[model samples]
Target: MIEKAKDLYAQLIHAQELVDNSTRRKVLIDSMRELEASGVNCQSCTGCCCTFISNSMQTDGVQTLELYIYLHDKEMWNDSLISRLNEVIKNNRLDYEISTGQGSSFRRTYTCPFYNSGPKGCSISPESKPFGCLAFNALGKGVSAGENCTSNIEVLKQREDIFENNEQRANVYLKSILSLDWDKLPMPVALLRLHESIGKIL
Candidate 1:
């Protein structure tokens, strides 16, 4: 399992490198426009399946929520927040949901429920999981993936269209996905499914 995890990690790094190349994202909207023409459905891409999410120790609220589930199931959480998260889950409360960041992006009202503000740690999701952990399709060169992100289908497809060459696209795509370091974040609604995924994986 660890070897499998390492392989997954390597794949993520390759994608991250692509994203960091700048040559791919430098074109900005032109790439997006090209992908928009590709007939790919963001909702159906599922590239995120190869991805997982991780957080630093300071993340809280939704971040902690997700972490708690991860810790408890994986037995990774110490005597820290698991008990508290359990209480929250039992009570259907979200006190862990605190306001993070300032703007909608940094402080976007949404965060993963498993995020832990106190320790700032993340409970890693499994690889066979669906795609959010892998990719994000934010507009422009402004967006960046963090850790454990697989690769956004939209972004990967856009790489192909913009490069217009399979070999180059594949290389660039690998770099882009690795650039995120699997740091791509999964949207909230998608996060809601983690509990079930954990159940299946654990």
Candidate 2:
């Protein structure tokens, strides 16, 4: 499973031109840079966005594979990570599926396993982090629900436009690796399922 994910990552890197020249991605990056310059960023406050309080951060197979490879390279793909993911799922009832009508079902939200409650913030690098994570940013100078933070829907839409096709292809490839049929899933659940595919007991 790891090897297959690596192969996919390699293929993505090989075709990096689209990513490099994507105008939508450039706009999103520029917006982030502007926020940083204006001192409107997530710094001192706790990671409310990463928690299940109001977060439902979902990721497709491509985003999951990016994070998986990043963790493996950083020596973070170990028993500790597995345990954290499992605990998050069990504690928050993330395994339970809710019917969204029209024969669609979705999993519950939970704190992301990669969220380090420290200065480092997210364990995953910006490049490997999910688009939803990236687009959720601070809107003001300090913490406040109304003006302090929110998800930039426009930025998220821009990124989705740029990578939608890649996400579709990745989900198709990943279906052969795991028994799951979900195209996009809660971040922790997806990662845990992928790790379990290798039969490595937590």
Candidate 3:
């Protein structure tokens, strides 16, 4: 699984021209920093945005693959990580599909397993973090609670369009291997599914 993931990561890094041009990613991170400077103090506050009470972070296959590779590199992919994912799915009813009335179903909110109360607040890197998480930002000064924060929808759309315009090759490749047919899924569910599929290979 590790080798397979590493190979995929390297392939995508080259294919996506990530090393030469990570402009979109850089812009997203820069925007987040600007928002933080405007008084979005997430560093020292309780992570309300990451809790199941409000979190509904979703990701496509490409994002899930990036996260999987990151976890593997960090040596965070293990039995304990799998257990946490399974527990989150079961405890939060993340597997229950609620119809969206648009020919699709949406999973319930999931508390991010990597939402550590540590200094970083979240354990995942910005590179692998869900776009939904990256786009969400505090709206104004002195806003600690996530209530005042909202997604920079314009930025989110721009980033998403870039991937889609490229035919989402990475996402399609992931689905070919993992049989992940859905366009988007709760982050934990996507990660678990990706992990399960990788475990089956070789």
Candidate 4:
């Protein structure tokens, strides 16, 4: 599974390098619209997708930072939230590493910080949500809901392609701007790093 994730990452990187910025943006916009139209309602579900289950999608540092910035812009940042984020990272840090062909991977399982239990959904705008969150459909392959979901499989597949393509473009944009290898990082760790970065700049 780790190797498969790494290969997908590599492929995205390559695709992003080959594609132009304008074309990437257009694809992202069109795909996002289609994904929204698919309407696989999570309202009735238990928000299982927000929880870091055995095979939940991983987030990268760039997406984490973007989410943090979005919340900060909305005046959501406070000392209590920072402390909670720190505690989350400390409690969930993985002791062992999973080896991917590119390098050793460090990931952990934890409920997303942006997830709210009452509504049991994301606090941020859907547009600001991480690529992993946007790409994932409980109705898609490898999910428990696959059997029960009524969403058309064809539409779901198209959504997956668009999500994957946009995610690659996003990664490429991050790489060009940050000039760093944007390996997928555990959500807690990435959020913690984003908090620290904001502290430095502020």
Candidate 5:
């Protein structure tokens, strides 16, 4: 699975090199909308998935970082949020490495910094969420995947596949554009790296 992921990452990067920034952003936005339209409503779930951190289960770091960059470019990234994210990374000790059989992994448990309990959901716009978050139902099909979810299993699966495909491509694009490796880092750590890189360039 790790080798396959790397191969897909490479393909994604190669494909993005042919596209301009505007086109790439459009693709991301359009893909996000399509995923959102799949009827996987969170309702009052209050970020159930975001509440936990697991070594065995986690979101895609590369895709999350790409969303961060997109928001940063749009001037949506604020100092308060950046500071909060950095704090979360620090508190969780996200910088350390854990070794999986396949490779190094980062294992820690903490509420996702992007989760906003006041809103009972994510602080970021739905369109800007990582593909892993977007595809949760399709990929995991947990308790939330019951009748409460308006999306059918087939639809959810299709959307998940699409999101994953886009994410692989986006990760490749981001790796090439940002000159970063997108293998196995915790989400917060990846975000911190991205934040630092953006700070330097700015």
Candidate 6:
């Protein structure tokens, strides 16, 4: 399933080199560059995605890739993991961690599977380059709902116009992935049984 999904994913991507507005893309790119230079500590905080499950759609570019791979690797998705998945489905949550007040739309590892922790550094660094890594520019108050802001990622303050197009494109890309076999989409965590489910449903 993984290989097939990868191939299909590649094919769909190659089929259309959707040209993003060059000016908007450049602005987003510049924001990314500026954000990197600002030196915010994403590695240290790790944020909600690391522990809390993301209730949001799989649109977050590289995040979806990481999530899909994390769900499949049977080595990680054990019986306990399956049970967790069921609970998430039953509860209609992305996932939650009371230990740290993390909540998700569904129950799952909101933390990226590729995440590697070591004294030296995280296995995946922003510098490594990934498309979906969100550097969301927001209107105001960019911290935990109630937490005091240490400092705002000024990029979040950048022109909202920049993100409007990019976010749309990213979403379109992810949805294309989800559309391949909607009849029997992968259920629960690994999203592995999708084909089987589709087969049975048909």
**Which candidate tops TM-score?**
3
TM-score of each: 0.23, 0.82, 0.87, 0.58, 0.58, 0.40
The better candidate by lDDT, 4 or 6, is 4
Model 1 steric clash total: 55
Question: lDDT tens digits, residues 71-177, model 5?
Answer: 66566668787787688767776666566767655467766876765423666654555544544532222334232333244544555554556655676665665
Tell me how many clashing residue pairs each candidate has.
55, 0, 0, 0, 1, 12
The lDDT of model 6 is 0.39
- Give the better candidate number (1 or 3) by lDDT: 3
lDDT of 5 at 36: 48
**What is the lDDT of every predicted structure here?**
0.35, 0.70, 0.75, 0.53, 0.53, 0.39
Writing each residue's lDDT as its tens digit, candidate 2 over 1-202 gives 6676676556654543224223324556678779989987777667777767657777776677678878888989888888887898789877788899998776576777877774447877676777767777888787544246787998778777877676566557556555556777788888877666644321
In TM-score terms, candidate 5 sits at 0.58
Q: Give the per-residue lDDT of model 3 (tens digit) for 53-139.
A: 789888787778778888988989889998998899899998888899978776577679999864468988887787778887777
TM-score of 6: 0.40
Model 4 alpha-carbon miss at residue 180, Å = 6.8
Least well predicted 10-residue stretch by lDDT in candidate 6? 181-190
List, residue by residue over 83-150, the lDDT tens digit for candidate 4.
Answer: 76677666665323466667656455776777775443678776556544554454532333324333
Question: Which has the higher TM-score value, candidate number 1 or candidate number 2?
Answer: 2
Model 5 poorest 10 in a row by lDDT: 138-147
Error of 1 at 123 (Å): 4.7
lDDT score, candidate 1, position 10:
43
Model 2 lDDT-worst window of ten: 15-24
Best by lDDT: 3
Error of 6 at 154 (Å): 8.6
Per-residue lDDT tens digits for candidate 6, residues 1-202, read 5565455345434553323223323544566556546652243332443333332223343233434444454345456655655664456443332233453233233443344443212334343223333343222233332132222344434534455554445446555555432221113432433333222321
